[model samples]
Target: MPAVTVSNPLALPRLPEPGLDARPRPVLAVTTAPSGVEGEGFPVRRAFAGVNQSHLDPFIMMDQMGEVDYQAGEPKGTPWHPHRGFETVTYIIDGTFVHQDSHGGGGVITDGDTQWMTAGSGLLHIETPPESLVMSGGLFHGLQLWVNLPASDKMIKPKYQDIRGGSVKLLASEDGGALVRLIAGGIGGYEGPGITHTPITMTHVSVNPGAQVTLPWRSDFNALAYSLAGSGSAGIERRPFHLGQAVVFGDGDSLTIRADEVQDSRSANFEVVLLGGQPIREPVAWYGPFVMNSHRELQQAMEDFQAGRLGTVPTS
Candidate 1:
């Protein structure tokens, strides 16, 4: 996709191999995402569906939005809606999106840009394609990830961050055969631009054919990998996976991924999104748009939203 790329990944900073003492995480599970329609009928792959919540912990859900090319007048987006007790990270890889929220946060994010919105207490928000994009539709591909906020921060004020593509920290594998786009969190002393309330790391990796990459991970954080395109294998046992699949790893200090020597013609490299976060380990009472610690709290959120305490949608 058109997220971000360099003419020579070899020129980028390299990630050193994990030390001999680093424990290699084992692949716990591999699941294929089910396709679904979302946000006014736009296509999406439910990336985290069917995975056990205990393994997901701090993460609630993820949707891989549109790797499809839209025809003129075919672009779609979400209607204004309310959310509470979590964060929404929308990363645009190949197209454009416009976001606006009642908290006075709004922006247009195009290729490789990210919009991070923390709907902590509550807020009304909407996302759509720009008028121009709707008129001359082209490729649209991206991911929207939902991160849970711990109870302590769940009711804090909402926040927003507009992270541009150029701000991402780029690095390569030790052998220079893979590109790592650090979107948020830290790795080997390099930090990404997006700020988060939870301890987490997000990276997009593209591994060349026959290449292998090993990443040093935080032992305290849970590890996950989702395939965006092409073929690859994960962990010490080399469990194979392809596009639209997600991998969960057992406890360890490192993660290993290897690209197939011969990939399908559609993709040149094995593209994956790596995510890990410190588990919240608290009760998760989640409903349509609200996530809270208890059923009573969820009821309160729904009542508050209906009463417009979340904030009113702005006038055009």
Candidate 2:
């Protein structure tokens, strides 16, 4: 990867009207992405937020991992792996992850930090635990999102963005407890500060229990929400979902929402990753550590890896 070059935000594609589907398209309620391949010694992938199902566009995939074992004094880390033709974004809410890659960039990311890396052509990277955090049994909660590179920019030089927590804005709802912080796109006039290759809306929101909120959405884009902490209710049908679940929306510009009455005195905080872009609809040939548009492309990527083409670290 190279030094970060701040550029004007990329323009978004036109939207499309919703069409009746045979089923509810899984509603993103509790779907999973193709994650969790065998790691160096261990592999435990907790959740796959979205991938081909909801985001056939500017976004590719998203995953959530935690040093969640509350068994005091032990943190976890995913060792080295290879990624070609895409980017890996790590947002830390708790604990830390030390990342070193073949593309020449390496660093330790602390809590409340966002490290967005673009592995354009190819890269070999390792994510390990810092001795202090792992040995001390540090708490860890974080997410990793993958953004697809445009065809023209797929092979461009790799790079990274180490966005500090303070760099992102935080917005609170009227109740003071229900809040929203725009991460990628704009929210209530708070435009996120970071590089983007697509028009996306990724925000984190937490609503107080029983608070009724009218959340907004794009008229022509596919929209959905995931619960991070407490149960959330949305839709004309008044659907309810708990933690580790997502709810997909039908055609609508906004939603009627409320917190579950089942839990009245707990925090309803959550990480909501909103995304919408013109569907690439391109064929996807995905295997462990590789994602390509076609089987031939997949085969080529494998050959490249076998030939040691992914032997260097990325620049940041």
Candidate 3:
């Protein structure tokens, strides 16, 4: 008998704009999820959490919450919780987030701050409180993403990163398009900051109105786009994708994209989340706040927290 060595799924090879002259694929489906949870708090509202859309890539969950009341003394967020089998990435857009952990790491994440938490073996932490943001109502927007971990790496050491917005490279075009990012993974042609434990890429981009941008991608990698700020055109089928939606591109021998800004968004900032990665199609046992491979593993995580053997602190 031979030992079975788990291998990482192939993530899409990131390619630069296909020089704007490549052939394109039409998007097959343009779907939308009207409402979903913002997080542990907030009542169910019209949040564009990427839950209802794309699973084309390793991008599992997306939660975009705004109107997050960041009063100086009041805290609004999830309490001490556990996560395994995946990592959660948070980006603050309007306010700040006070993060603490079981690893003696804690900090105040202000707008543009990026925190990438790898909950490999398992992790118990509290997010929010000691308010990092103070403000009245407007758009306290931000994003939450869950990156799946391969079975072999599920018990790897947990890690965290605080990549400031200014630290991330932002490139702009003469027109309306721009790219801000690289919280993780690499976009070779574009020098982005932040690195990841596994194979993945997360970036924010804008497609100028009526201007088409072609992106080169690998046949093996999974790719998907999220409609964040403005309406736009995307996907292999090249159909219409409105705000608060995500389009998961199908896997084929070709990876092509052609996007033109919608008429109403011609002058608007067509914001979208560009993500691609290898899929860990392993079985997932997800609980309220923790995710493991089986019920027994999840039970161990909870038991560790109760017994205090899971030595980690949420005080970065």
Candidate 4:
């Protein structure tokens, strides 16, 4: 529960590559209304890196949980479950989410807080609406992303990082037209507070109409942008995207996102989550919440969970 501050405030210098400025990354594909499915007990919209298209290396899946309002006393959430061989990044935007894991780690993540949990080996956990929220009835909105672990670090040890909203660095445009929240990795010269096993950048950006920002990224990493709220255009193609939509980018060392028109009246801005990471092109054997390099390893994970070796969560 320590604060993570920006260690550097200057943009990382890039080597001069021919045509780097001239070449803006192009949007490889646009996914709208990615197949919806019920996860645990809550409704979730699978954006990318799911069963159908799991090739986005280092990124396993992204789920946008209920932008829905729940009535008082309604039960809605994921019960106890086990995960291994990866990390789960939960960014809560509006409602209170209480978490408890078998490792005796848990917390309440409300507006703008992020819970980064590494189920490196194995762990059982539950994510649900806080008793207060469930009894009062209110809006709940958030995003959960799964990041893959390299084969070498698959069983390094479980860890957790609970990042508060205020602790995250917010960068504003010189013209005051855009704001970027650096959650993890580096943006320009500023860096987010969350540490990572694999190299990646997680940014939540808000852009006003007619405003645009070009973000430098590692050329070798795969990139994806998810439209969480409002609509916007991205890449050299200036592809138009809407809420619940995800845009996958092709090879490039940088990305440009522009807000063509404001979609929210209250904020008069377009919002998006940009994620990029170095690709781990190793083979994947996935089953339920477990992801391993081979099927045999996945079986071992199941066996461990069944044998009670992963630990147990408190019932109360």
The model with the greatest TM-score is 1
Off by over 4 Å in 4: 1-22, 35-40, 49-55, 264-267
TM of each candidate vs. truth: 0.98, 0.78, 0.78, 0.89
Candidate ranking under TM-score, highest first, comes to 1, 4, 2, 3
TM-score of candidate 4 against the unseen true structure = 0.89
- The sequence of per-residue lDDT tens digits that candidate 3 reaches over residues 179-229 is 334455555466556676557777766555655445555455667776665
| Best-to-worst lDDT order | 1, 4, 3, 2
Backbone clashes in model 1, listed as residue pairs: none
* lDDT of each candidate versus the true structure: 0.93, 0.59, 0.60, 0.79
Q: State the lDDT of candidate 4 residue by residue for 1-316, as single tens digits.
A: 0122223323422222224464567888888756464545666778774323443778988898867777887647787899999999999877888888998897999888999999999899989887787789877778899999999999988999999998887776545566778899986667899999989999887777878777777787778898877778989679998777888888877888888664763335677889988888888898999999999999999999999888786767
Candidate 2 residue-wise lDDT, 1-316, digit = tens: 0011112111221122123332222243444333363343322343444533544455666666642643445555666688877777787766677888886786887766788888877888888768876567646666777767666665667788887777765655444434455566764445766676555666666555666545455555566665555676666567766666556666556544457655532243333445544445555566777767777877888898888888844444
- Model 1 Cα lDDT, one tens digit per residue, 126-202: 99999999999999999999999999999999989999999999999999999999999987778888888999999
